[model samples]
Target: MITEKCVRDSFAEQAGYCKILGSSFMSDLLTGLGKQLDKSTETGRRVLQWSGDPAHKADALALRLAGALHALARSGQDQALAKFYHNPELSSDAEFIPAVLSAIAANDDELYQWLEFAPQTNEVARASIIYSGLSVIAKRFGLPLSLYEMGCSGGLNLQCAQFGYQFKGVEFGDNASILQLSPDWSGELPPDANVEILSRQGCDLNPLSVMDADDAAKLVAYLWPDQPLRIARVEAAIAIAKNDPPKLEKADAAAWVEDRFQADGAKGNVRVLYDTIAWNYFPDPVKDRIDQHMHEVGSAANADNPIAWLTFEFDEEDKGPFLKLRTWPGGGQAEILASADPHVNKIHWLQEN
Candidate 1:
């Protein structure tokens, strides 16, 4: 059951997320839209009794609405609203709110259908942090990596090794590649060792296909209107993906990890299971099962065929995202390599300068 207050709060929370991530335009837009939705007789009458896991309904609704708006804009149904997004000067102009509202009212049916699924932000820049983590692990183990990712939307990060990276005066990967991540780096540089990815695979409940035009558009829809650079990055990744889409399997996160661990590690390879900003979405039971399976596999790891769990997730005590690495055979403790923003706009390495 979705209450008016519940919907408002969800929008408010997403507003906060956008504001913190440096999108004043989206933050204000969402706040105004939420208030309008709370007071709209049309919305109340048209939007059906909300259906989904109660925990995610609010965010789901907000994302669905955003998708609807993007869909309308891309379809050129609302030139005014579309212009507001395409031009920077038009942002923060409250005059556009009425147009946005009208767009929503016209497409309430499609928006409601979108609410059935959770938002798949599909942030690929996060793979920059993952690349750093992998580089460190490779330096330690000296073996090629077999990568597995949980909640990999289009599995763009699976191809992180193919993209160029620039961090604190250091550069790696294909310098000629169109996509590159150069986050504001603070503290000491990460290991300079080259990490070889022998394979890349991931699991998503409903994976987006980078090769599909509609699927790629949905990813763009999820981006905040305020960030042009991010929009370009997604486009760059999509272009690269068109040539060779990353291997993504549709499956439950915990089930995939358990199945992967059922067999011994391949000879002379280091199996690394990694996820970024995706850990919190998993239910307790699923997380518990994945954790148990990883420990079991880590315990049996040998020097020649080792295992590592690399994560860029929130540390409860620190109340922030940290880049962490835990390995087997010799790695029993998780190491905090760096602390980062929810997006890879900024990263602070924990290593000594």
Candidate 2:
């Protein structure tokens, strides 16, 4: 059912997403990259028949090339292209991009290996929106929070407490922390609440270990070349994670949620389940199991102990992704909170916090 146009269309949409997210450099590069894929080169053919789900078609190919280019640039193996990524002046010269891409695609072995892996964006900038939501939940519940994240690659966000946060001019977390998040915060600030992370754990189908050099490189490589700030944040987060890595397990999300909800939380812990942009990948049955489990466990929740689900994901009919929160003991009805750009560039708060 997959046609070449299907592949081309995915890239075109992804390119637009990059542009809207403030990465004009990535937008241009991806536009050029799509044309290169249409040329039926070895790389193009490989991408044309991508074996993964349709939702990931474009991202899978883009990440493969980006990761390979990043590896080369980091090793100083391709000084010309390395400078292109580091210096905006050189990369903006559109005339030089085709040659650079061609040279990158010439390495068949590397590209092939990259194609074998899925795109693990593991973007940490999104932590800004997540932090905002979590702050709201903790304040609403007034209980020590126990966090569990699904689709947590490298589990960097699981270490969010270690990173500093700045929302609408209010700041918190380790001020000395290198990984600070001060996004273009807008709207009236949510009620300031004390956050206590009693425990944190995460699960990914194929989890990357921050402790492993090769795994860490893949995580860093997936970052867009033009966004130096994002690249820097990933590097800083990796360094922070090395000291104390998250308790990440390689497991299926539905099964993990079932097990987590079935177990009893300590006396006063508020069990929190959350993820950013990871829900769409779950199959229908998996989604059903998780939903049913949440409802069943939620019915048993009491005021002294609680359960909350926080999600930042795409809503097909909405202008952008919606931030929805549902809490038990008060009845787990979904409350639409905010709509944010795909990369969390800007957020529009919809409810009074």
Candidate 3:
């Protein structure tokens, strides 16, 4: 039996020395691990410890095999990869880490092969925060929003604006916004405010069409394992899409925003906003183009017909994550209101100096 203490120590060991795996790869590994909890025994615990050792040349390979084990456990399938995992000679092999990293980087059939072992769950917590944040922004802007999300995988976050939110101490359920915003405020909740979502649309370079169940599952599998709420949120979003799908377009973010900004309906009683956690993936030129387009649109905008750019992303200074608010007509500096969690959950409002 693998005691909880053993598991914790194992995870700590893995977490401390696995920086060489790169953040994105580590995220994927953690997510895979989350799904494999049931099948993770004492042997698996020892394997995780072995995988975390910085001095071990085969750590990366062990991690890869562990991820494979998790994927298998999630899929409700037999552990066919157990032989590869249990090989003693493979543990000390110098080439193991590099090989595993190469496989993940390639995103080849091996990645999918490992993914087949995991079960999907709801991971809506981050989306809930986004909905909450949007609600606050809409109130501040004095307009209903027609949200346009970039890099929306399966359009799950889009539905947060359409669904309901039920937190521990607070209860507010109407039309959900991009993030669900209702915490049990013991004192007083923000004034009985509401933002009409004129429309909800999203674009993804590699959009996961929810019409296909397998694609939907893959999207869920891609989510972080620590975020179980996201899994539920995704499942709910999938259900909503099946009933009445949101309008999703397949296009590049810069091109999509530029074209949409130039379109007629882009100027309406709605605020057009793009929120993404995808800055690292985009090139500098693409980022520049997006900024230019938003600036152009903002210059032409008015209080009567306002346009806003609201973003929750990471920057160099703050390092973690922050929310930026920019508006039209009064085109000034973007205000960093809160220092937020990368996962979009805990937000510490920054005090102005």
Candidate 4:
């Protein structure tokens, strides 16, 4: 049972993250709301009495509430709330607090319903790290790759190479691409190798497609209002994805991996399973099964058809996610390439590559 203390703690915890992620307004808003949320209202009752662990790594309860309110503000139904959100620095807590409370009371049903779904921020900026990892893999194996991603919200990162990147003075990808990113980069550059992806596929329990207007809106909405650059980057990436939409399927990741993907068949091409900031959402059972299947499949792998598991995800030891790579011959042992910001603004490469 999630205690009231735990629920409140989650809001405070998420507020801290908001500050770290460069959203002082959101941090302030969450802190204020946690102290003042009226438990008598439907939305407040639902949040205060939530059943599950409400932490960002768990149910992300705070983010859900934040997203819901942001959506309402964007919809233009509450002009006062919209003004506060758009110009947060100019609004005082006295005005902001009451507007939020009034908004919650009026749209309790909608906000409550919004909390049911997890936030899917298919961040495109993280591609800088991912493409860099692929460079290392390509340099090592010198083979074309077959890319598969699990928990791919809209499969935007599946089409990462389609977007452009400029890592610390190093240029990569198509220069003409609309959604270009130059994350604050560190460490030596990986030796250039052709990362020709023969095919790219992704699976998720609830895959959002770039073609869906509602899904695209939600994807953009999940970003903090203060960080308009992040929001604009995702929007541009979504536009890029629409031209050559990602090949995505709605399916269980473990089931898909065990039943469909095989490490042995694709001769002369390296099979790569990669995910960016999506591993935490997987249930423990699913994660275990996926690991087991990879190990089993890897056991039969060879030099001609190598299998690689690449990830930009949180490990037990780090504050942020690490770019990790594990190969077939070296099953169960992953090399930590670099550590990066969750939203992909900075990266410190641990390895020279």
Q: Highest TM-score: which candidate?
A: 1
lDDT per model vs. reference: 0.79, 0.77, 0.56, 0.85
Residue by residue across 7-32, what tens digits does model 2's lDDT show? 66666677787788777766766666
lDDT tens digits, residue span 230-313, model 1? 888888988887887768899999999999875477779899999987788788999999998898888889999899999999
Let me know the TM-score candidate 2 reaches against the reference structure: 0.85
Q: Which ten residues in a row have the lowest lDDT in candidate 1?
A: 47-56
For residues 19-95, could you state the per-residue lDDT of candidate 3 as single tens digits? 44333334334334433433234443444343233222323333444455434434544333322233423433544
RMSD of 3: 10.3
Q: lDDT score, residue 201, model 2? A: 95
Model 3 residue runs over 4 Å out of place are: 1-123, 166-168, 173-192, 223-227, 263-268, 350-353
Clashes of each: 0, 0, 27, 0
TM-score-better candidate, 1 vs 4 = 1
Compare candidates 2 and 3 on TM-score and give the better one: 2
What would you estimate as the lDDT of candidate 2? 0.77
Candidate 2 has which clashing residue pairs, if any?
none
Candidate RMSDs in Å, in order, are: 2.9, 3.2, 10.3, 2.8
Question: What does candidate 4 score in Cα RMSD to the true structure?
Answer: 2.8
TM-scores, one per candidate: 0.88, 0.85, 0.64, 0.87
